[model samples]
Target: MSQRLRLLSVLASSLLLSACVSSPKKPAPVEDRNPQPARTAAPASAPVPPAPTAPEPKPAPGAENAGKPGYYTVKPGDALIRIALDNGQSWRDVAKWNNLENPNRIEVGQVLRVVPPGVDAAAVAARPIASAPRAEARPLDAKPAAASASAASSAAVTAAKEPAVKDKDKDSAADDDTLAWGWPVANPVTAGFDEQRNKGLDFAGKPGDAVLAVADGRVVYAGSGLRGYGNLVIIKHNNTYLTAYAHNRAMLVEQDQVVRKGQRIAEMGSTESDTVKLHFEVRKLGKPVDPAKLLPAR
Candidate 1:
């Protein structure tokens, strides 16, 4: 019995020792390894940048010279010869006036002096405006003796008043005083001058009818270079006036040739028009005037 008791005690002591060795220990308090994320809300997404702005556009070609005096802004497709023709100036004179080394090298948007250097915008504006001649109405029962006396007194008064007429009249006289204007064509009244539509007179005739010059002048332009004026002839009647004959079947005059009033310069045709016709234009300072007003009464 004693031996059995000693063996049981030794087994119980070994079991207790094994339990103490295998039991888990309390873990050391764990430290927080990572910090908390930022509390503030993420900044609002960057503002979307505005779209790039467009640049301003440029103005029309000749808009810069609108209403400007004596200065003509160059337009696209404008040739020096055509410019001179429209302005009633000699191309060489214009070239020299502008100091252009090359007449053919004119640039768009360039301002050109169409008149002489001494002649300014005021002079250009002072040019004459041609109008139809006015007739005075006589009293139906007036006596011839009374009329004669009235005429004599009226003449005396007119001489005193003549000096103070608008400067335009004097300017016109300066240009047309020596020119004895004659009718360009005998046939009349197919179409008349309209500032908006027709710039001059048009007469219907056969394809080879004679086209005459209305006044003495030098031919500055005689060719088909001007558009809408096929086979055109331009005459520089004087410093202030020019005449254009267009739609000709043939041009008889040449550039720099002087022509007299009633001289046949071209043969009428429908070069640019629909039917056979003569298109006559009278220009003062590059602006067209009514030929009927300037032409002598038929």
Candidate 2:
């Protein structure tokens, strides 16, 4: 019984020593292998885009006037006649240069050519135009042809009523005494009218000699704008007659003024002539006719 008591004490001591020793740690929980990604902040706002623009237009073809010379801008109160007078050109020629459909109709701000396209101003004015061939002079005291269409028409009617066998000399003498006719000046004629050499008659006179209108008419132009006719005066006797008195020292009448037959209209001088003379011309429809054809015999 003593031996059994010794063995039980030893076993009790061993168990106490084992209890005082360290206790077993619990197994660690299984850990996850992968981790979640971190969250990011959102942007405040989106950037603004740019605006679109419009495209440009193109020009049309052949819009410019080509091969033409310098032009003149028309002004108010301007007429083709006045412009032609100022520029030393004929109104008809000016119309031809500008391709004008209506000579009397031109608007302000319209462009016109002052000079001709190919011809020069001085050249055009100096060029002589030929007239019909006729005897230069008839009898010095012979009666002239009718000066105007109206006069000619009346003469025709009178001629028609007269018998074909009537004496021409007697009728001519009577007509010369009845028609309104007068001289342009008191001086002797230095040069007679010739179609080739002279376009009109030249009358020799002292400086400041009175130049008279041969018939009743209205002044159409009174200026020195024409190169060959210095201080010229143009008279419109009727729709079919126009008379020019050139190379005058002074003009006594203005354009559009009325004057009776034998009225003094200018003073004779050597403005563009060789001497102190009156250069007289008669134009029918712009073509020069012999003044002797319309002037009464001296």
Candidate 3:
């Protein structure tokens, strides 16, 4: 019975050891029930560039030479004051140039050398003004017959002193003296010259009409290289004058060709104009002048 009790105790100990060795492991607790999505580093943003701008244009050359005092020839009927204003100089400069005590003493065919401000005052003061020549008159005392003949002679002299009526008639046919003269086309002038705005004159004509030159010159340029002057023709008159014709349908004269006055140089067209017309410009020393002052009266 004692042996049976020992075996039973041993069996109980073995059972306890087996229970300790066969125990299961427990899982760790989760903060969230559902698993979160995997997070990636955000992509770096790119930098943007700025837009570009256009370049500015350069000023015209020799513009600084303008308004400088210089010498000018006095044509027929040119007043001293008028010449001074045309050259951008003052009337005082004209008086000082000619050494005139009175500004109204200027005569035709005179060469006046004008000086600008801050010039030599002593040189101007040294020059003497020219005076007009005087004529002697006949005596009044004489016989009655001689007096009657003298009175008749005086009437003739009085008539000669008066302005010639025939001169008034010829005044309308006077020649234009303005530089860079040119005819627009074989038609009436439709538009006159405007310096700042138009820069030229327009002649009224049908499409494909003949255009002529106003004076003898050589064609310097005969292409449309210049902007706003389509199918252009430029003629060099002298050293100081140039004439330009634009919007032509056909050019009869080529570059460097010598052309005479009233010669056909081009045909009128509407390439640059709404209506068919000739665009004519006369430039004197690179400056534009009124074409009406240069063209003959119709």
Q: Please, what are the lDDT tens digits per residue for candidate 2 over residues 100-125?
A: 77676777666666565765534434
lDDT, candidates in the order shown = 0.68, 0.61, 0.56
Q: How well does model 3 score by local distance difference test?
A: 0.56
TM-scores for all candidates: the values are 0.59, 0.44, 0.41
Top-scoring candidate (lDDT): 1
For candidate 2, report its TM-score: 0.44
187: Cα error in model 3, Å: 1.3
Give the clashing residue pairs of candidate 2, or none.
none
Q: Per-residue lDDT for 1-298 in model 1, tens only?
A: 9999999999999999999899967899989899898798778898899999998867643456655676666666677766665666766667777788867677777777767777766656523222321212222122222113443454345335432222211122334666678888887679988877788998989866778888877777666655566667887777778898888876666666766777777777777678889989898777778988888888
Judged by TM-score, which candidate is best? 1
At residue 154, give the lDDT of candidate 2.
41
- The TM-score between candidate 3 and the true structure equals 0.41
Clashing pairs in 1: none
